[model samples]
Target chain A: MEGFIIALFVCMVLALISKYLSIPAIPFYILAGVILGKAGLGVVHSDEISRFFSEMGLLFLLFFMGLELKLERIIANPSKVLKGGFIGLTIDMGIGFIAAYLLGFSLMESFIVGAAFYITSTAIVITSLIENRKLMFKETETIIWVTIFEDIVLIVILALLSASDQNLLFFFAKIALALVFMYGISYYGKEFLVSILDRDDELPILFTFAAVLTTASFALFLGIPETLMVIALGAALATTDPDAFEQHARPFKDVFLVLFFVFFGITIDFSGGINWFIIAVICSLAIVSKLISGMIIGLTIHGSALSGLEIWSNTISRGEFSIALAVLYGSPVIATTIAALVIVTSIVGSFTAKYSTWLRRGIVSRSRKKALMHRPH
Target chain B: MTLRSLNLPGVGTKYEFETDKGDTVAIFFTKTGIIQMYTLQKGCKTPSAAEMSPVEARRLGNILTGAIIEADQESVEIAFSALADLRITIHTFFVTPAVVGKTIEELQIRAKTGTTVIAVCRHDRNIINPPPTFAFEKGDAALVIGESDQIKTFEREIMVN
Candidate 1:
């Protein structure tokens, strides 16, 4: 308890600093965990409270993601999302998986690495775009869509992974049944749901909180993954009043998610023989793969290589989801490697994202100079 | 006149357009009902951005919808010439307590003030050309037509105390 309190206090201070610097707090939280946990001073251990807070953090994060997953938009433009998403899945995940496989990790470990590698930190990417004021740029749309695509893929990956150990058919059947049940409730109770949400009293907040917890608890009761259940709950609520749920649920997600990241960092065990070469290679591939995939997305979707460069620059940071994947499913070695990958890529990605414009300009000017020089005299 | 909207995933939807002034304006309506507006001037790299709460955004929307300088109340008054020298006017009045629950025939409005009650707007329902036996209710807006002075007399005597 004392350790958890001290850890949160440190995270709070770190969060303030990260906010002040206009950087994503995710990497910092993980790094703070690395410093405070078994790998560092060994002051903080994962207690029940911390673990529960961490679980809430991950659940609420997915719940928020599910709430924001406006299916209409994706349905409205299926081709763009598919093309960009497919290319990204193939390139980033393919590379991460292939490289990890070749590096002597088990196939499952490679799959986990590849999954983490494939997902760019949506939080980091979106925040940087708005902070950098790149929202108005033409490439910004493609960048945003690619993140959405990644989110969708993340959900699918999570589902597949959760169902891997169980009877696949039964798992999917249960999921479908749960989904239908949820949708039915949402459809039938739409008016009641909206009325409750519209209320300014504590009922709305309580309903939102209870709805999530109920879904999670019910999922456990039904032998369904609470992760999927909460997401389903969020999606069902989204049809009625997503904004209300988001507003009411945000306070819990915000505080808990901070602990989630911090505790994830704290729980990382690095004593399992560090592999620097493999870690360096995977980290490098994380950047290179995004660059390749982002460029493809740019050239094909946006018709500008420079736009691809811009997308690549913004997306290189793999923070929250990557760490989540690592913490949730990864072995100790995989966790340590991913933690390193996240710390390195996020810090490097921040600088690259910030100066991406300058990088693009330099490349453009250099190419123009070459064209000028190559012209017949 | 043309607007492009993009889904911002975890954020909300963003509607953007280049204004006639050649400045690009983007408005983001977040999933949580907060609104963020950004304007980028031509040839500028950065945009000026402002965030508004839902209430603030709605207030601004109301202003933009011209709620502040609403349609003039007199615009509701209709005037026409029945004869070259005589002008008839139509107007609306809020039914106060003095006129509430009073039937048109009982009030004898047409006989006393020479004004015909054209309609009674109660809540969302409008009673057009209300009958003589129609009773006025509190909160009803009575639409009447007559000579200007007669309408004035009707308002002074019937619509209010």
Candidate 2:
């Protein structure tokens, strides 16, 4: 069908744009989605295909997250990552929860919004940090550690999202059972498989993907949450041969992620149902709350206000997870608004982070000037 | 052997490490230790890459070499903060008669300056974690990890008449 070809063309154009611009490619992908999907020309119309791929994208995203997750490192103590993540999560979710309620969303939708805003895009921040040679600095390190914690927190939210719609006990119990089984298989299976194959690279990936797919299919047949099953599979696989998956499966994740974003874009009706003002307000509030969240986390880590600001600046963008949440719980109004917010924050977040030093200095000088003007002789 | 090196002439060398899945990971490294990475997969001919620059090429190189593993944010902070006691610094001495002839043991850098010479990079040599018996040569640049005050102490010994 033309669906696959149309998807490829959109992704290609987005890729070209990303090549010239020094930003995360997600927002651009979204833009491509906007142009090609229902919001625009309506070129690709197969909802079933797009939906399936989007679901796959979500699995792949979490899978990649699992691969990069240095579980042992994080578990190794009551360290900065834990501390900052704890503080950031508190502020982000707490503020987001209040804000969502004030805006009149249901309890479920409020949780979704809070969870969505609670995360800063690790992909965007890490990219900029390395590009600008900011990693050597203490603040950048704080961001990295904080991101690890954020990932774990988001995983919890993802679990909640999957369990949100269901009769809690049923969904959660099955998910738990599935997770236990998956973990045992992944943890034990890794060593057994490695004996049969050494550093071959291809096998671990193929095996893991195959296993996850099988689990997903089985879950679907059994009426369990397939998304949660895949996520559990990914996290468990992380305990096994992470290097191989990171090397091989990551590329597939990226490809599918592009598909997911395009699908997300297509589903959004950028027309007229959503209130633009509410979107604008929430978007603005998201910016402030994220800054506050990052700052608290950063401050807790390094005990510096500037460090907190740097953290905020570093991770202001919302990407895959946020969009996934929006698609799930967000109404047409909310989804469209979120798309706009993601686009704005992604660009703004990068700029703020890149020129944080200058921005800080400018603020300091202006405040000094204000103090001088107010002083009595 | 799909891991071919491309000379980006103006930028520096780019190493494209193609995984067995036919996914290409290109790490573009510059002389000054800047590293940018890109990945291509899915038979998408257009190389729509993310400029993955979250760590130094030097640090990443060390990671690849197993010199560092999982030195995450907290651990790195602790290590750097500990540098108040002693830090890492590199200095190159352009072949002086006084400093060139002494062996590392004779130079006694650790004893005198509390500075351990982690590596000695000659123009044509890679002497990482050099032995104490490693003799000092003209134009030897040493990467030392020590306290600031101690680095000053060691610099004097290396810059002789």
Candidate 3:
């Protein structure tokens, strides 16, 4: 109990520091977790309660992500979401897989690692956009489409990765079933559920929680990971009147998310057993590789080099998704490595976002001056 | 009727009107800022979209071409007026205490020396053309527009020694 209190306090301090400094909180939280964890100070240990909260955090993260994704918006630009997203994911994941494989990871490990890096943190991107006042910029529309696309792609990848060694047709059929069930619930089941909430004003929060848990459990029952299902369900819910449902659900989502980050910090092992040098190298490579891949794909699709660079820089931020994947399937060595990489990437990405605009503006101004100097008098 | 049109510098179109059958001729400005004059004509038809709203078609016809032309004009003007440029920089030492709750006009007067408060940066956000009643806060960076000599005087007076 005393240890838990200390852990919670540490997390709060780290969160505050990160917020004030305009830095990613993930690294500090992970550092705090490492210090309190069994591998470092041995103040905090992996327990059932912590594990449970961590899982809940993952559930809520997905739910919130799902809520943000409005299906109607995707429907309006299906090709931009699906085709562009798929291509971007394929290229990014392929590059990452090759890099991991060459670094001595097995095919399966490489595949998982590659998949981890393919997904971008929409939360980070959105926050950066708002901070920079670029949310309404011309490039923002493209970024939103691509980011949403990447999220859906992550869901599909998670689904495929978690599947057993079944035939392709069987795997596809299962996915189809999941989709039908998701659509059925979203379309028909939501109205009945919403009406019940309407009758009872206090029931909305309870209903949202119940719906998330039940859908996640159902997905687990069907041999699918709850993470994908939770996201899908949240997405389904998002299709409803966002203002009506979101206001109630947002607080719950935030609380669970904070707990998730705290739990993530507490579980990470920062023992000397892992090679810090290797981790640093891998983290740098991961950020650079992902940034390059995103830039290439964004430029190809959007036809703007600057827009591509901005998207690339923003998308390079790795957070909960990578850690979640690492914890679920990776060995402690792999998990620690991935966690360290995510922390580094997030910090670098945030700083990149903070300064990228200034740098771009400087370049533009210099070029304009050059043009003026060369003008025929 | 004698109708005359002139290409006004730094402005768009200007039309002048005169009439042979003028009787107590009076000119009135329309709500849309266009000047109207009563005159007799052989025939009149409302202008087509091509003539009335050429900007829309020009924008659609080629955005890059339009942007290039606009940019060229701006560059030419800036180059020609380069000597008239006045740059000013003001530093506030006790921004939070001195500036907060002070009106823009008050700050302008306090800063004095002819410096114009053009913009303020706070919390990593830039506020341009800040209102008169806008209060300054801690860590706020202000962009003052004035001559170098005036800016130096303004900073010395308003900023903490």
DockQ winner among the candidates?
1
Please give, as one word, the docking class of candidate 1.
Answer: acceptable
DockQ for candidate 2, C-alpha atoms? 0.03
Best candidate, lDDT: 1
Number of the top TM-score candidate: 1
List per-candidate RMSD values in Å: 9.0, 14.6, 18.5
List runs of model 2 lying over 4 Å from the truth. A164-171, A195-205, A361-377, B1-161
Q: Across residues A263-357, which tens digit of lDDT does each residue of candidate 3 receive? A: 66666665537777667767777777766766776677767667667676667787777777787787777787777777778888888787877
Model 1: residue A149 alpha-carbon error in angstroms: 1.5
Give per-residue CA lDDT, model 2, range A176-274, as digits (tens): 787788888777776785553355646756765676578779888867766666666666876766555555666777788888888788777966577
Cα shift from native, residue A296, model 3 (Å): 2.6
Model 3 spans > 4 angstroms off:
A82-87, A165-182, A199-201, A270-272, A369-377, B1-161
Give the per-residue lDDT digits (tens) of candidate 3, residues B1-161. Answer: 56555321111233445446542222222112333333223242111111213444344334433322333121001122475753333332225466666777776643467766677878888889778778777677776655556656765666543
Q: Write the per-residue lDDT of candidate 1 for residues B82-152, one digit (tens) a residue.
A: 55656556666777798789899999998889999888889989889888999988788877888778977
Candidate 1 residue-wise lDDT, A286-365, digit = tens: 99999999999999987888889998999999988898898789998999999989888898888888899889889988
* Candidate 1 TM-score, true structure as reference: 0.78
Task: Please list the residue runs of candidate 1 whose C-alpha ends up more than 4 Å from where it truly belongs after superposition.
Answer: A374-377, B19-24, B29-161
Interface RMSD of each: 2.5, 14.1, 20.4
TM-score of chain B of 1: 0.51
RMSD of 2: 14.6
